[model samples]
Target: MADIPAEGLPPADYAALCDFLRARTGLSFTEAKRYFVDRRIAARMAAVGVATLRDYLNVLRFQASGEELQRLVNLMTVNETYFFREKYQLDCLVRSVLDELARNRRPGSRLRIWSAGCATGEEPYSIAIMLLEQWSRVDEYEIEILASDIDSAVLERAREGIYDERALQGLPAHLRSKYFQPVRGALAADGARWRIIEELRESVDFSLVNIADPRQVQAFRGIDVIFCRNLLIYFDDLGRREAAGMFYDALAPNGFICLGHSESMSRMSSLFVPRRFPDAILYQKPAEGGAS
Candidate 1:
């Protein structure tokens, strides 16, 4: 741990907190940390009268409940995502996954995707748009996306299916005009609380789910694709190993796993086989019963 600051705070209080969080959650720390972490944790600090960051650490070190533990991870994890983020992946999903389904025409056979850390619904919604655009012919087949996050607040926001006008970047004219309507000022709530376009909202299912808890997700099996992006830099070696194992168990044969650019399944190399799509990079579950 770093030294405490002369002002009784830790020398890089947020940095220390970041270290603590990585050990606790599988999320990462990045720039603007103080602005982000402090702004979220300060209220709890004030409530406890823990004037110094070091003092707060002491309490966490000494006595913290399960709820406190959850709050720490939920608040610290970043949820900065946008619609159609990593567009190449969406394109790959369209042309590769759905395209195969279209040609083969699997009857009532479903393709299940899990946006494992879907923050504010962007990933899943983008996926919905892709499915709608590319596989409209498969209207009878169920293509359900299970979008989840550790943060309940974020899950609630995701369920709303809205965004700030500013946050939407590079959105095509067709999508912007069709999917979103102007929220009077903030962009999340339109025209003094007009609702999200019901069609987009219907496409996604959002919920609070923590990836670390395997017991909480008994039914999370046979997923076709798992998007666990930009949410793994926080975990230490042990955490990553355990998470990778869980992901392996959760996936069916040939199911794809997408990690953040910075994250690697290298340590658990046996569990997945790296493969490249036309516009994206992905890993598939390795030989299940000798066939991938």
Candidate 2:
């Protein structure tokens, strides 16, 4: 939340340094945000042996060749997301999307969903479980869940397919008992250890991806539905526009693009048409919009 003038900021412009981070990593800031940024970036101050942000940036640019910039990006873009984080969106999907998919399902068809920026495995696993709950034989449709994030650390953790019991706070007792194992070892000492059932874990494929880079575009291929929630708020207007365009192109014809509750496509029209639903609003490419 701190937006102290970047000009000659204390001990050499840490405030201005944050502005640089806004462009580099797409973090918006204010006075309250300054504390989080200062606390996190200041940790690097010790690593670089530099007393200031200016020195840190200098090292990243000229001196340190390894673990400098990459670590900075990791530290900056890491966002905390959890399974069934937004009940409203899931409700809309269960009510509207599922109905549409059921009605639209051909004799035999699959549903493809991409949880872009899936932090750990929560979101995709949530989707898989929802589908399983809906259909006794959920495997009938070809379901593909692509979960991606820029951080390798989180990606590895997501692959582990583990969580804490706290994630099941709102889950029905039957589902919670059915899905999670009661780990009671030294680790279970915390009383919050959780392991996602094998059935849900197998439904998703995880990968290290940067949405900004064009090279990873193929990772989003043939996506029918996207849950790009809570991630894009980090980007500035221009970055948001570019990222939205990429998603629109990645989605198939009539494919649904779900954004965070805070996001919208009022201006973005490169490939998506905003469609209002009863609860959650998503963008879809019109039938006339190019290739599916």
Candidate 3:
């Protein structure tokens, strides 16, 4: 077996750390995620020159201002996302879902889209771009995009709307050229960098939100669709159930949900029914369910 790092949490410490994190963030760390949690915690501990996990836990629990806890959360939360991820899902949203909306929605009604865990704003911005692409009469229809993430750091970046070339990899060349312009300063690399256009950047509203916190998430309601991809996989059963219920309540009746390609609401909650499209599978809060 490989040797454990000196800063690595022992079994008991690991268990305690998991409990601490779960209580605050509602994210459960199973044995399968042990290495990931360990590495993140160990690195944070090392940065502060802490020798034991117990000491770090004390800092998290008793520290004034809760800065340490926020730091840990920022480090622990995964923010791996790119433009136009899971293209088929976006395609379905633009084609099938929007078709349903256009037919059913009343006149002068806006489409409200929430991108939960919208790290760095790619998902919500993608939604906006897709809406613009699919809807020709853009000026006639209002589009409201609310993008949120638990990590404040990522939200700041999302608001900036600047990305390196790597983050633009999945974005189509034509769309990228049309929507982004080169940044002309030392802060960004010469031709390899781009920033979202003012119109598209302003189309989204970014905020800090913890989906596990019922009080925080309760603010989201009457949403026409939610894009919460690769997020529930990190939560425990309780967390998943609670978040799913919140999502169910947040949606307008018949509103849709698009999760990560690998994620499913089955076995987790009965709130949403599976809806299949030619290219993707989605979940829907039934119109007949009477507010789930």
Using lDDT as the measure, which candidate wins? 3
Candidate 2: stretches off by over 4 Å: 1-24, 28-32, 51-55, 58-66, 98-109, 135-137, 267-271, 290-292
> Which ranges of candidate 1 are over 4 A from the true structure?
1-24, 27-42, 48-67, 100-105, 184-195, 287-292
lDDT of 3 by residue, 175-195 (tens): 999999988778575556788
Clashes of 3: 0
Output the lDDT of residue 36, model 2. Answer: 63
Candidate number that wins on lDDT, 1 or 2: 2
**CA shift of 203, model 2, Å:** 1.5
Ranking by lDDT: 3, 2, 1
On TM-score, the candidate that comes out on top is: 3
Q: Cα lDDT of all candidates, in order? A: 0.71, 0.71, 0.84
In TM-score terms, candidate 2 sits at 0.82
Better of 2 and 3 by lDDT: 3
Q: Which run of 10 residues does model 2 get worst, by summed lDDT?
A: 1-10
lDDT of model 2, residue 76: 71
